[model samples]
Target: MQIEQQAAIVTGGASGLGAATARALAARGAKVAVLDRNADGAAALAREIGADGQAIGIGCDITDTASVLAALDAARAAHGSARLLLNVAGIGTAKRIVGKDGAPAPLEDFERVVRVNLVGTYNVTRLVVAEMVKLAPLADGERGVVVNTASVAAFDGQVGQEAYAASKGGIVGMTLPLARDLAQFGVRVCTIAPGLFLTPLMAELPQAVQESLAASIPFPKRLGKPEEFAQLAAAIIENPALNGEVIRLDGALRLPPR
Candidate 1:
């Protein structure tokens, strides 16, 4: 579907990949709603995108039904029902199932990661699709599209990444099923499993560490840019045939076991 003049909702829009996507969508003439847990950051980015009301920012916790409902309501009120939903809000953890001290990992930690990454993604998608289905189909018989974020760790999980890997793996697992379920409604689903990239969290590491991570990629030996991710997302939306696929944005990099 043409992104121009469409309403788009991007979760985790306050920063990182989500921020880049919001900006990209807005640039393509989509009225964007930046939903994030960071209220101030979200509002700030919205202001940066456009002061003429082309975008809005709402504080949202995708894991909470009430929060998501309120966010969707506000978004619809401001920009009409969203035709594009980008699920990018997620968290990571680095804890071994059996720690060095020979203790089991905290169950809460695993639950939190899965809750935010997998379950939270589903929560937002379900709510957004509910409204998207009500809208009249476009010329292509498409009502909406959803793009979810995963990680290469899902497939190449290293030591201490059990929680993060499992959570992202769930996203990878659900892509095709989600597409099939939403086919009748003309909503497509896809996923992106990104490798090491310079996100806000990654940037916090020392320069040497960052460079080391970048060197692991086989080609274009540098970190993936957020704009590159945004470009792919926009591409997925435009290409009607691309559905239920998980494309890796990692410069041909296969992560090593840590």
Candidate 2:
């Protein structure tokens, strides 16, 4: 599970937590593949890592099975079998199931969120696990580690987050079973349910809005940093016994109902 010189695949590597994890992995000497739908951003990040030969950029829409398959194939071609799989690609939106407009939020929107956030994670995880099983195990017989991104909303979703919460809940539910199934293969699975983080998407909000969200935290009263999440991922990959759990990086803050 030592990251050095090993192949790692990071979905949504173009920005946010995904980008941070990819950079961290590369910095730790891992051959990283920046997989994302944002082709330009992914390519730019790969170049910035200064390992164009070892770091690659692959464009993919994780919701589409064919697109994900192609992305995984491209990564395998570039860096051999990937031993680290990071599932960080997802989308979120807020809408009441019933609205003042006299019509409920479109079902398509809910489906889209679930498809990308939940199904997408499963798609990439399945493909990567298959490939990881083919590789020879490392010391301690560990073949690979999968780090998935969930959300604090899974446990404390507000009024308008029905779709988002359900999707994240699915990920949290799968973590332990996945670890149990992959254990014999020396593949560890864990999920990180992050609270508010200073990701690019959140940066778009008004300053006051951002501050309000941060202030809601019981301690620190600030957004979590991407590097903090990356640190946990690094630790999970190295610790053989830390499997089958969803660790919240929420600074002891449980969210309130909105």
The Cα local distance difference test for each model comes to 0.95, 0.92
Q: Can you tell me which runs of candidate 1 are displaced by over 4 Å?
A: none
Report the Cα lDDT for residue 163, model 1: 90
Structural similarity to truth (TM-score) of each candidate: 0.99, 0.98
lDDT of 2 by residue, 115-212 (tens): 99999999999988998988898768999999999999999999999999999999999999999999989899999999999999999999999999
Best by lDDT: 1
User: Once model 2 is optimally superposed onto the true structure by TM-score, how far is the C-alpha of residue 97 displaced, in angstroms?
Assistant: 0.4
Candidate 2 global CA lDDT score: 0.92
| Model 1 clash number | 0
Candidate closest to the true structure, highest TM-score: 1
Candidate 1, residues 61-169, lDDT tens digits: the string is 9999999999999999998999999999999989989988999999999999999999999999999998899899999899999999999999999989999999999
Query: lDDT of model 2 at residue 250?
Result: 94
Q: List clash counts for every candidate, in order.
A: 0, 0
Cα shift from native, residue 73, model 2 (Å): 1.7
